[model samples]
Target: MEGCRNSKDYMMDVAGRVFVLGVGIDNVNLGEALKRIQEYVENGTAGLVVTANPEIVMLARKSPDFKAYLDNALMVTADGIGILIGARLLGRPIKQRVTGIDLTTALFEQAAAKKYKFYFVGAKPGVAEAAAENIRKAYPGIEIIGIQHGYFNDDSKIIDDIKIKKPDILLAALGMGKQEKWIEERVKPAGVPVSIGVGGSFDVFSGEAKRAPKWIQDAGIEWLYRLIRQPSRFWRMLQLPKFLGAIILSRLFSGK
Candidate 1:
């Protein structure tokens, strides 16, 4: 709502349920968020995440439910440097970008420590298997109850599978807003304590797509690097200018 700068008022929306957080914040870092997420998982709780890409924040401004869902989310962190900049401009800057992918890795580590089981859901073809195998290799002894690719139509089907496994953590790599909506409607109400929408992170983690180097990520140029690496991103890149305009207009007119 308040230009995506308010972390205390975090959350974004979709058609299904309340997202616990929003973008355009820059206060929480991966370390702090890892702690918060650990607290939630250890206690059996749930939340949502929207990367603070300018386009998403801009979309949050235009979409009523998106803004409200984000506002109601339990945690929202700045996932992009642009959002950090926006928050600074608004004088309520968050401290760092909390990337969903990085958070997933941290969560896996924490789950390993706690012996928590995780469910890998969504993504096409070999992505899910690769991600699961990669995780198993990276973090030994963490239980992965089950794995399913993002190819189903009936949401109930996936819900049934997840209900059976009852993993402590569920990571949906269905990409962007769609992933949020899917989990909100199908996963959250089914009693999933913690479910997050990870956009294409599975691919990168699984080595399907090459992630940037450490320096590239630190420079906050990962996005640009991604766009350059993935030509398919050209269409997605088109969303930026539109999102940017929406943010400015929302600020000027007080769009909620």
Candidate 2:
């Protein structure tokens, strides 16, 4: 199916208010875009959201426990440019590549313009605060509701504080399955309207991480560059190849 732009489907959540993306297969919905922010503000639960690619989906299929996490996400935006191209190769055209970093940045820019408060949850120690500071410096007058490291036990006290502060936006960086499951489990029921699962965006926003240059991003070779930078990530990123294999294999089976 072609990406359904502006289409919304209410997802299963504590609040039953989540919306899934359709228009741009890779582009997630704004309602789901801001899920994490709303969760901390309303319920103080920070979550992980994954930018799932076909390979990751395949991986999930192999790991039923992990598959459950992926299934629980409020929304899963297709992040890889390859996913878009592969979809085309498979005869399904996805028009755009929506990244977690870009998505969160876009949402924040819009919220800042509207005088909204923001809470950045997740990221390694200090990453969230650095991202919050970077955003504040970039946009003067943006209310940074709060920031917290993504690592914490279920009993973390920041939850209570977040509920009290009530920021309009919350950006979570807990990464993939965990973040998405977090948002779906929280928010809406708590009455917070927006939460964004930002993955490693905190690292990029904080200068602790680096992204591919504009040209690389446009070329869809961002993965190659990341592989060069962090050879260690190679193992995990094998999901890309696995994704391609899944598509090819599926095609073969369908043709039979």
Candidate 3:
């Protein structure tokens, strides 16, 4: 996403948008979102797409700069169940919850058909490489031109390499703030047309982690399943209430 645009009028017809905490999140279906992404890729649009979750939103609250960064993204999609509930509470409904992993998977499928060049960055030692290998096996003709792990100390070298590769799209799996900031500060300047922060998706695609069952996903309790598996996340889950409280106050005051 390339910042808030006057072109939102044209986009709203396909998938309406709603702003939460000054960050605009697109309310489009997967197909419509992909169409918009393809348009960006074809036209050489320089932007990042943020699959925003409640935690990401809360992070934005602490960093006004990061909030502005997200507001400037080419597009932001509702990637967490909490975001969906917040929208409903505000009286504007997002059509669906589009998780980052799902979006990344869909993009891989499209890349196979469209022959889009892709670059993978972030994750631990050999994680990104494994993800790329799995993707190649699953999607024949996908052009993953480069792979880089997340441990590098120098971003300039990484950006320089990506500049040489000239990938059409880049997926950075460097957690949340690090990933988004990396895309905004490094990938965009390197001239990657489309970049997204795909937190932990590499782990799942690389077979290092597993997604919840369809029923669990559909029920919108994937967070619970994740908690059951990784109880260490309980501290992060504390932010959920704060997120909801902010949404409630926003509705009361702004009448959204």
Question: Which 10 residues in a row give candidate 2 its minimum summed lDDT?
Answer: 1-10
| Deviation in Å, model 3, residue 211 alpha carbon | 0.8
lDDT for 148 (candidate 2): 82
| Model 3 CA lDDT for position 29 | 75
Global Cα lDDT for candidate 2: 0.62
Which sections of candidate 2 miss by over 4 Å? 1-50, 63-74, 187-189
Q: What tens digits encode model 1's per-residue C-alpha lDDT throughout 1-256?
A: 4544444333323322212123424356788777766677778776665555666666676687776656555566666666665555443546677788878888788776777788888888788898888888988888989788888777677788888888877888887667777777677777777787787888887888888889999998887898988888888777666654544544454433
* Model 2 per-residue lDDT tens digits across residues 133-176: 88888877788877789888772476666678876666777876
How well does candidate 2 match the true structure in TM-score terms? 0.75
lDDT of 1 at 134: 87
Highest lDDT: give the candidate number: 3
Query: How many clashing residue pairs are found in candidate 2?
Result: 18
Alpha carbon lDDT of each predicted model:
0.69, 0.62, 0.84
lDDT of 3: 0.84
Model 3 CA deviation exceeding 4 Å by range: 1-15
Instruction: Give per-model TM-scores.
Output: 0.83, 0.75, 0.92
